[model samples]
Target: MIPALRQDRGQAFPIYVVMVAGLLFLAFAFFAVGQASATRNGAQGAADSAALAAAQRAREELGLRFPGVLTAPGGLDDIFKDEGFVAAARDEAVSFGAKNHADLLPGGWQPHPGRTGQFEFTVTVQTQYTVGRSVIPGTEQDHAKASATAVIELRCGLPPGSGGDNAPAPPPVTITCDGQDVPVDPLPKLEKIFTVKLVD
Candidate 1:
């Protein structure tokens, strides 16, 4: 009877060992998946932030140069081609990407297709940190990347006859929005004039 019992215990021990080993492997696999997901989410967040920051910076530039845009000849065309405008936008993109633990790839900031005159910007970023060692192979050296697009669309408009060739706009500019008057000077009420958002 004692020998029979001993043999039964040995058989059960091997089954238990196999079950524990399988469970540990599953746990490691799940942990690796979680790590990968975290990296991907971080990359996406950085891209969205960088794009929005760039668009917002461009919006501010427009507000600062709003007076010239209204009175200068070919003003509408000139502001779009302004080197300073593009530079400011790119600076903001790079700054925001760094803040979010990512790097904006070269030429990663570009204009959106079929969407001219919207102050549109698309930003792409790669995570500064790689996914750490995991159960999955090659994950230790993997870096996540993501892209997002944000736009600064004009929401508020100037007063009637405030725009056009050689038409002088009156100030302090009284822009109306949501049933209230927003002043456009001493900072041009830019937030009121433009809506900044992530489109992609």
Candidate 2:
């Protein structure tokens, strides 16, 4: 009876060892998954930064040009439908992406408008770093990629007689932005009138 009991105990010891080894591997795999998730979140953050930065730069440019557009015939239409700045703003996006440790992909502009003077920029990026070695296959060489769209919307209400599209906005017009009046004379307060942000 003593010999039989000892033999049973020896068999159970190997079973316990196997169970512990499997649990350790599973824990390691979970850790690897956590690492990959963190990397993906970082990539998304970079994409958002790149796209928002580009939109803000374009807003600044628009601010500098707004009052002048009020005088030029068809300028408001051009301003509202402008796709020129998106291409010009690519350098800005690239700089921003680099700051966030990512690189911008080509063809960042989405030309369709939400309304007059609304533009969307679609930015795609790839992380500069890999997910690192993990139990997951190919993650050691994998780079997480993400895309974000930033929208540029005109916040101030266009004054009456602006004729919607293709008509020049007259000078001495006061536009309402966030319930405050901004005069077009002596430079329009465009920062309040133009808002740039990231869309989901």
Candidate 3:
């Protein structure tokens, strides 16, 4: 009887060891998954912020370049065609992506082509982060990518012949800067003529 019990004890010990090993493996897997998720979220956030920064800078540029037009009684059809305006916006997007520890993909900063009235910019960014310190073989480092779009809309309400000195006083013009609708009071001083936002 004693001999039989010793053999059973040896078998049970191996089973216990196997169970502990399996549990440890599962724990490591869960940890890796959680870490990857966090990294992805971070990458997404960076993309959003970068896109927004780019759009905001572009909005500012528009305000500065078309200060008189924005406040005057006119439409924004011609201003969108300015090449310098688009270039400035793209440069800002790249700079913002770099600041967020992400790199903008080549030709990733794209302005919507068909849509002329509203300004829309899209940016794609990539970021790499470590999921584990060489513990998960090929998963030691992972790459995360995200894309975001921002829009700038102009809103103005001017009375007919409002530009003339004899014309009645013009109502305050409002520009949709992202989500905020800011009023542009007085002339030659455009305020919030454009807005920035993340579309995706």
Best by lDDT: 1
> After superposing candidate 1, which stretches have Cα over 4 Å from the reference?
74-83, 113-117, 165-188
Order of all candidates by TM-score, from best down to worst?
2, 1, 3
TM-score of 3: 0.76
Residue 24 deviation, candidate 3, in Å? 0.9
Which parts of model 3 are misplaced by more than 4 Å? 1-3, 70-74, 113-116, 128-136, 161-192
Q: For each candidate in the order shown, give its overall lDDT on alpha carbons.
A: 0.77, 0.76, 0.67
Q: Write the per-residue lDDT of candidate 2 for residues 31-89, one digit (tens) a residue.
A: 99998998899889998988888888878777767776665666455675556666666
Q: Write the per-residue lDDT of candidate 3 for residues 1-40, one digit (tens) a residue.
A: 9999999999899999999999999898788788778777
lDDT of 2 at 115: 64
Pairs of residues at least 3 apart in sequence or in different chains that clash in candidate 1? 184-188
**Residue 159: error of model 1 in Å?**
3.5
